[model samples]
Target: MMMIELLKPDYIFESSWEVCNKVGGIYTVLSTRAKTLQDAFPDKIFFIGPDVWSGKENPLFSEDENCLKDWCAYARESDGLKIRVGRWNIPGSPITILVDFTPFYAQKNDIYGQAWCDFQVDSLHAYGDYDEASMFAYAAGKVVESFYRHCLSKKDRVVYHANEWMTGLGALYLRKHVPEIATIFTTHATSIGRSIAGNNKPLYDYLFAYNGDQMAGELNMQSKHSIEKQTAHHVDCFTTVSEITNNECRELLDKSADVVLMNGFEDDFVPKGNTFVARRKKARQAMLNLANKLLGTKLTDETLIVGTSGRYEFKNKGINVYLESLNRLTRDKNLKRDVLAFINVPGWVGDPREDLIARLKSKEQFTTPLEVPFITHWLHNMNHDQVLDMLKYLNMSNAPESKVKVIFVPCYLDGNDGIWNMHYYDLILGYDLSVYPSYYEPWGYTPLESIAFHVPTVTTDLAGFGLWVNSLKGRFSELADGVKVIHRTDYNYSEVADVIKDTVSDFSALSAAEIKKIRKNAAAIAEKALWKHFIQYYYEAYDIALRNAEKRLAL
Candidate 1:
């Protein structure tokens, strides 16, 4: 087989709303994938993110004033681009620029007007976080622009990649100001597509018939749609995280991706050999201990641990369906073992439950429930909390004699949630099964992460990861295959719930040997999704951008 010669850039500057700030899946995408790029590109790559932390101590960042002291000083003095040069506290520890965009709020109108004039971005209808995100993006563009002009050469091949609609303005700004630099704009999910799906609209079936501009108007999403659509059209190599999102782009943004950059991860996040086993054991014990203390149950190692985790979009993230599935599973007589389902989505959490904390500390295992035993965290409004409300509606008490129980962990498990002091990944490894039956997942990282930790996952064909799994198998997968990609549709909530119920019930009955094989298969599936394999798509994207930049330069 002949190797393809991809265009390698002399310098690469990538910008995102989630670079070092751990907001959502994009943070995982960038942080996990950074090791591969750092290895390949060495010192040629830089990441820019919004300094939302301000002067507060950010655990994710390690400031290095001396590393880029000259540029930091120059950029601040000359451009008013308040930036903190640091290394992100991830595997690669890649150079990161966290720009304070507070200073740019005063210039918001001028920036919006300039974007409108240059790229036809209709920021006139902007609202809420639009101005904030745009100003940050604009600042990132100026940050890159100043860095490029001051510290870089015209002869050096440079590519500026912007992630999501939040960074679309930066890509547009770079194009208008620094045309010498190639640009790539990646949209994980189209603004209109997510809006359509999140609003309970039939997205896939009605996708082609839906006009983006029309939907943007109806949904009051004109500003975001305008920026995203215009950026996709203008970028040298427009990309999406998956093929499904690319389809959304074709219909919603009227532009096809030059390449699909499938999100991938480094295996360094997963523990090795004995450490893996030890950690998995500890995680399981921790979870079981928490459940036993909270519910006052003797849910031992025999219990089947299951969970669903992601951003808490009640309908879109399928928290509703996950709860419904667990509710259905509770009644299924086929469930051979006690199933403990954890709804690990963060919400408007007030604090950790004091009663639960006290119970967790006590040696006595009281055989009774605590108040609001379903959740470990105290939410601001228990009445308005969707997960708790759904639990109440389903009558899903952590009742004794029930075959299954659901627990809502409504806080970020950052090693100090006051309940289980384990990080999200460490806590998640305890699970035998994970589910992300998403209604609007562009790329499902939660399920992918599950499989990486040798945990079988149940996701939907509506998810890009699920589709990719099916493609690998050439047919729909089952729990035994490490990933069970359920068929999910807008109208098939009940059917999807039943499938998850059945899947979890079946997963509970697998023999130890069968379970080991399935776990191995899960690891194998995750290996195929590592950045070593998936980073080729990024190379392809770079080649497209560089060649396009060359064409523009020639003219």
Candidate 2:
């Protein structure tokens, strides 16, 4: 085999819908890895995002009116571009530009027409946020092209990386307008794959039999799928977050990934020694106090605080499986110790439960259980919610008679959920164990975040993180290794639930020293996943992208 020479870019521009916006898992991927990229390139890296917070305060962004002063003025005059330059409030504090794409909506048709003419991207069947996301993407590409023309020399090597299908238009636009600039398009998850899974179809079992274009049309994903497939085929490099997602790209996008860019995390968000202990203690106390007040029964420290949290995807995130497992745990007559399962998934909550708030404020234990004690907050439609319906179906009333109690925290834990009044990390540190039984996770971050905080977690083999754990041990992972890789299949929902119940029962029965050892091991696993260790893969990706760009330019 001939040896491959490594190449690097002089400048890198990464555009995503989540750059300054914290939407989903992609935000975690970019924010946590920003510091590592900044250390290597200094001020050479720039992040492009949509300017949603035009006149409002964006806590994640620290705007600087003078950071890109001359370029901003020149671009506005020459290209009609609207932008705000700032530093993202992440570890790396990388330079970020939030583009105002509102003005471009009027010209969406012309832009979509050009995209179809140049790259064969089919936006004719677009609906909902498809037009909005494409406008942002097109605006981002324009921003990069204008900046390159005004600031950089033609001889300089540059790379433009767009993340997810939402930004596929940007990558395609960059490749068309500035053919000299290399481009990398990463699909964290394919549109058709997600649609298939979300609609209760078996994505994995029937993956090989499905045609990308045919499925796109049948599933009403034509517009997003067309752009993603075209960008993947046209870009200098195509990448995905994991081996599992790469397979999805091959089967659904008709393209094999140039690289599998595993997501990495920074440990700077975790608190240090004494602070960590203090926060954990405080979190546990608050959790127990609220449980006591809501259920009218005092829960001791020894009660196993189990949790499952993510987007409210009833099936995709395995919320149904998790609840079913909890339902089983609640009725297990042999289970001796108490287990408090918290569903921290945010929903359409209206306000905090006033009765629970009043009870907590009075510093008095309630003699009677509050009405509808299962949820911490008041939801917009409590009667019609799916989670509530499931709980009702399981008859989990969190009464004084049950050995296991389940609580629903239906609001984001951003230090103002009105109950915990703590950040998610602070609140999650209180959990003795976390469970993430995902059905369609491209790269699981919640489980990784749990282990990072020294909380042993349960995840299924279907998740990328769970597969990584299995790779380390070459067998089923157990609680002793800081994780339990439960064997899950498309049809093994009940089996997975049984496994989770058994795992939690076994964990609750462990001795103090054994639990401490497991916690230590969990932290060690997180150490292996830090950005410092995983940054090397990014370097590998950058090299592949640059070398491919060189070959294209040569032709």
Q: Give TM-scores for every candidate, taking all chains together and pairing residue i with residue i.
A: 0.98, 0.98
Evaluate residue 347 in candidate 1 and report its C-alpha lDDT on the 0 to 100 scale: 92
lDDT (10s digit) by residue, model 1, range 1-555: 998688889999999999888889999999998989998988679999989888688999999989888888899899878899989999888999999988888888898888888888999899999988998898999999999988998889999999999999999998989999999999999999999998889998888899999999999999999999999999899999888888899999999999999989777878988999999999999988888888888998999999999898999989999898888887798999998889888899998988988888888978998887888988998899898888899988888989788889999989888889889999888999998999999999999999999898999999999889999999998888889999987799999999998888887788999999999999899999999999989999999999999999899
Model 1 scores worst on lDDT over the 10 consecutive residues at: 263-272
Task: Encode model 2's per-residue lDDT on 70-124: one tens digit a residue.
Answer: 9999888889998999899988899999999999989999999999999999999
After TM-score superposition, the amount by which residue 396's alpha carbon in candidate 1 deviates from its true location, in angstroms, is 1.8
After best superposition, candidate 2 residue 1: deviation in angstroms? 10
Per-candidate clash tally: 0, 0
Q: How far is candidate 2 from the true structure (C-alpha RMSD, Å)?
A: 1.2
* Residue runs of model 1 more than 4 Å from their true location after superposition: 1-4
Return the lDDT, model 2, position 288: 88
